[model samples]
Target: MTELQRKLYRQAFALALITIFYNIAEGMISTYMGFQDETIALFGFGIDSVIETISGIGVAHMILRIQQNPNTPRDAFEIKALKITGFSFYILTAGLVVTSVYNLYSGQKPETTFWGLVIASISIFTMWALIWAKMRVGRALDSKPIIADAGCTRVCLYMSVILLISSLTYEITGLPYIDAVGALALAWFALKEGRECFEKAKSISVCGCSDGCH
Candidate 1:
């Protein structure tokens, strides 16, 4: 790799690490609060964070491999990772959809969502910052996986917004179903992302391209 490519790879690596750490922390807190309050939306959001962390680790591993051996043919690994990420998103979507429907049917309401509000609010800003940085680096390198990772972060931003709005609305109006609505929204977004990721993977696989497939 050229020095410039190396620099971008290093930046990508750092961003991936940052994503992993942030998501882990966010996932733990959100999951705990979600279960404690019986909030489907928050719990689903936490699960998404965990999946994103896995995706980030895959991206980080790819970046490291490229940095170490610039000529490595990354087609196989990239395809596999993309497929896994895409499949995970589909799983998340299914879970959220099923849970949301159940909650709606049972009229389940979250007992307290103050923590959900705070967590989602914090995640919004953090995700925006990470998205900006990831996009900048991904665009600089014309790296498809990195760019796709940024798109994943963008989905997280949307999820945070949904969580914040739903939590606040429920808190204000004491409407239990709104939480399920938010979860359904998350499911839709996840489905879209999953399809896109799968398509990207398919494209790369068909073209037999490496890391610079873009």
Candidate 2:
């Protein structure tokens, strides 16, 4: 690796650490508020944040490994980690779908979603910045795992938007189903991300490359 690439790897590692910490805090707050308000969407979003933190830790470990031994080939451990992350996403998708359907069927309504709105709004900006940094570093280093991690962050951004819109719409109209709809949207987004992560993992296992790499 060149000096610049080394620098980028260091930056990516730092960013991964930041992602871990941020997601921990976000997940705790969101989950707490979710339970307090009985909001399925917010609760699911918090779980997703926790899962993303796992991915961030994996990415950080991979970056450190690569930095320590630049010539090391992608190994089974890394592939397994990616697969686990991908599988977790699929599980999240299924859970969200089931929960949303139940919420819709039961006509459940949140008691209050003020904190959901606040958290989602803050998440949007934070995730955007993280996505930008991760993409920049991933592209610079041509690291599939880092890029895939960034893609995960992008999904989080979409979830934040969904949460924000659903919370706001519910606050304004007092519609209960809209919150369920947002959870469905989150499920759809997570399904897409899960597929992408699995595909990337397959590609790396077979050819040691991500989709965009030649």
Candidate 3:
């Protein structure tokens, strides 16, 4: 790689590290606040963040691997990470589905969705920034794996929007089931993420593209 490309690779690797740390921090805060307010959406969102952290580690490692050799296949480390991320995502999906159903049937209501609103807003901004930066670096390097990682960030942006809307709706209408509905919405995304993880593992490319990670 040329010096400029190497620099871009460094940037890409840094972004992955940023994503991992941010997910960890977000997971802790959201889980705590979700428990305090009993907001299923926020609680589930927190769990998803934890899963993202695992995926981020794999992504980070992929960046390092490709930085050294762009044509490399998914290594054992990346495959292991993807498998863990996939299974965790499936478990979270199942748990969210069960919890959401029970909450709906029990007429459960959160004390407040205030924390959801806060976390979602912050996440919206953070995810957007990360997506933009990752995309820029990916395009600069002409790296498919990095671009696909950016796509994943876009998914997180979508989830944040869901959380924001659900939190605001519950706050505005005082609806008892809105939180559960939001959890269900999140569960759909969780299922998609889980499936993507497995698909990526099936592909040789780090991004799961059959042609190549580039």
TM-scores of the models, in the given order? 0.90, 0.90, 0.95
| Model 3 per-residue lDDT tens digits across residues 26-136 | 999999999999999999999999999999999998888887787667787887887899899999999999999999999999999998999999999999999999999
Q: Which candidate comes out best when scored by lDDT?
A: 3
Candidate closest to the true structure, highest TM-score: 3
Scored against the true structure, residue 173 in model 3 reaches a CA lDDT of: 100
Colliding residue pairs in candidate 2: none
Ranking by lDDT: 3, 1, 2
lDDT for predicted candidate 1 compared with the true structure: 0.86
lDDT of 2 by residue, 1-214 (tens): 6889889988999999999999999989988899889998898889888878777776777788888886666666767776887798899999989988998999999997788899999999999999999999988887776787788788789899999999999999999898889889888887887787788678777787422331
Runs off by more than 4 Å, candidate 1: 69-71, 212-214
Superposing every Cα of model 1 onto the true structure, what RMSD results? 1.9
Pairs that clash in candidate 3: none
